[model samples]
Target: MVAKYVMLADTTRCINCKACEVACRAEWDTPLGYSRDWVKEVESVNAKGMPELQIFPGRCQHCDDAPCVEVCPTGASWKREDGIVLVDHDICSGCELCVPACPYDARWLNPVTNTISKCTFCQPRIDKGLQPACVETCVGNALIFGDANDPNSEVSILLKTKEWQRLITDEVNIGPNHYYYTAGKTIPVEVMPKLHERHLAGKSIESIVNPLGTIGIGGMMAVFLGAGVKKLVDRRKEVSEKEDNHEHH
Candidate 1:
């Protein structure tokens, strides 16, 4: 089996310090009012019957079946061979079709570049044999990244031994690669991904644009076929009438 990269998040050990967020910003120099990654702080009662802050470090799920790649008409949004979902700046059209398609709210249009931007798993750093910035700066060492397919990798062993859970809902389970280890604790309901109303433009492309194109092509083929059959039938009938006239004569 090929190596599939995955990020294992030990939510129980997360300190909610936002170190990962800072590290990501610094590494990418992300613009103002947008971020590539985030730490979700959900205030709720913990297992101890006391109000506790639940932290979930979130980013692009790098799903095995990603919706962003599906809605992108330009084919700019694509997943890498190792499971990292990324957007190509040159091919992106700033149409924002991918924005609403993402259930995790991971994609956004860059205000500066006018292109789609999202977490790349720090692909450049990974290519250079270094870890992602967020994983490197995690204060609690909660974030673990490696090839899950490798038997010798730490993530592979942890996944085998630990009871890990994915943030998947019944309605929209796209096979996200991120894993969460709650350490016998229940996750807060607030942080779960909710169903988003798709944007009008994106909706039309799927519902109107594609179906219309198919219908148009099919309709044209049907018209030409009907005309050809009619002409052939007329020609045969005309020849039959001439043969009858000759016999009568």
Candidate 2:
């Protein structure tokens, strides 16, 4: 039996204390600039004349078909067999390609390792048959972690019973494991970090210019091949003309 882990977020129950964020950073010793996990505050406007704010904690989705893994040049980003997304710090080239490839704004570069880092789903505790530190420490019990692959698992059962929405775009279709449930107004896209913009538009000058090179080389090859065939045909025509001249002479 393969072991699997899933993260279930009940935004309705979330108090936005940032306990998960603190616990994750403490356990992993994550640097200042990089965060292995964090909470997002999803606020609603006072349009309904209600004086209140709704909070939503956000973290790595650990999508099944992760774009980070697909775009990583060094193969540093990889999804675990159990479904958690992680980075191989040793193999990471600190290229920042994976950083912007993620739609959830999960990936970040750790100053210490200078490699892409994101949530691991707390693999170490799961190995010891324990829930993730964040899950265990969650005061409101808003965060739930279990094997989503199993229908009987807590997360799977909650997902079926609760109203949930995955924060993602239609094109990527990563099959996000993280589920955020809320009855309040949905968060605006402007508030969320735009992680895919760089990757979609080609982040660096190198990433953009290299593809043009491939197109240029292919075009040049086609032109050269066409010119070679034309020269061959002209030579054949010249030989025939000379032979006819000799015959007529």
Candidate 3:
């Protein structure tokens, strides 16, 4: 049977030490301004009118029907048989089309590679029979990663024994694989996925390039295609020169 991987974050157990964040950065060489995973602290008043704080460790939800995959013109985004969503960096045009498509705000354009980047469930480590960096380094053991298809897997067992809720909204239901164990408590509004707004660049693409593509306007499409190609070339050259300079230092 094909393995179906899933991740569980027990909100009751997280300590907000940021160990997972640190480990992910070290593992992926993520740029200083960005991260693959994060811990969100939600402060709310409970039913008893007492202050309560819920800590949620979050990342790409790795949805079953990922909108990012559906909207990519270059097919750079894809999902593996094991359910890990990833970007094919070599093919990515850095068009940033998939960024707003994700409701969870998971995808980002990497400054170094000029490609879309997101959490991959630590595929390289998993391929070598190791846990994800974040899961392995979690200080409170709140993060769990394993094959949900395997009944004996820890995640599967947890799902069977524990009450969990996924972060979902009425407007966006993508069947996210990330689960949160909240012990039957109502999930806080702060922890839910918010509606994304298209940036100026995204709006421009939608209004101009998308319409041209749809109507098969060959000349205009070619012009837009050339611009995309030029951007990719410029980025690659920039990265190459930086690498050469680093080697000489």
Candidate 4:
């Protein structure tokens, strides 16, 4: 039995060229406005207090203790048989709730399809005995992928030999399967990109396309509210007219 797990990234080796992002887009035909994977450009303050830029390739961590799966009301999000966390598009209702539940911002609602999508660890390629698109396209060999459970596998060996750490936060312990080998104390936000505040500032259901079904719902709500208020005004007019008729009679 092959036990599936995650690969740790050695950030020191990454060149921030974004080959992984391109490969992912090409292979998946990701929409222009959204991506199943992303490369976050990070800038650190230099000694002169100027920003020094770096790039970090990020995707679904495929966490062992996944919070997205737990928070999802429909159970559309789940871990696959091989341990990769994935969303079942067939079951997803485009609620957009799971998007924020993910600490890594790994989940995204597809604007075209109106369903949630995220990284699947290239299960299709892995099943075919090929590396993930990102892993194969990495110019500097920065990304590595294999079974962490297998002691002889590349990922397992790397974890054992290298000083490594997992990205975590106290707020929500997602138990991210992705690991990192940075030569210093690990900060959760440092390993994961900081974009929640920005995302919150720009939050909207419009971020995900309004589906045909939802347009009716919105229209119905507006109509119902209008009719209810109009009915109340008409009732009040009727009562006043009845009192005047009774007095005249």
Candidate 3 lDDT over 69-110, as tens digits, reads 877778899999989999999899998888988888899999
For candidate 3, what is the TM-score? 0.80
Worst lDDT run of 10 residues, candidate 2, spans: 190-199
Indicate whether candidate 1 or candidate 4 has the larger TM-score. Answer: 1
RMSD of 3: 17.7
Better of 2 and 3 by lDDT: 3
Off by over 4 Å in 1: none
Model 1: how far is 200 from its true place, Å? Answer: 1.1
lDDT of each: 0.89, 0.78, 0.90, 0.76
- The residue pairs found clashing in candidate 1 are none
Give the candidates in order of lDDT, highest first: 3, 1, 2, 4
Summarize candidate 2's per-residue lDDT along 1-249 as a digit string, tens digits: 675676877877888888888888888898875667777654455777766566767778888878788878778888888988888888998888777778888878778878777888888888888888889989999999898778898888988887777766655556888777776457555434354645553455447667788889999999999999999999999999999999999
Backbone clashes in model 3, listed as residue pairs: none
Those runs of model 3 whose alpha carbons end farther than 4 Å from true positions after fitting are 196-249
Write one digit per residue (lDDT tens) for candidate 1, span 1-249.
Answer: 767989999998999899998999999888977899999988877558999777899999998889889878889998888888888899999889788888899988888899988999999999887999999999899999999889999999999999998988888788989999988767666767667447797888779998999999999999999999999999999999999999999
The best candidate by lDDT is 3
Estimate candidate 2's alpha-carbon lDDT, on a 0 to 1 scale.
Answer: 0.78
lDDT of 4 by residue, 1-249 (tens): 756868566777788888888898888888997778776666677668987665567788887777678666689998876689888888999887777767788888888778998988888898898999989998877789998778899998888888877766655555677877666634436655333222332234334344545887899999999999999999999999999999999
Clash count of each predicted structure: 0, 1, 0, 0
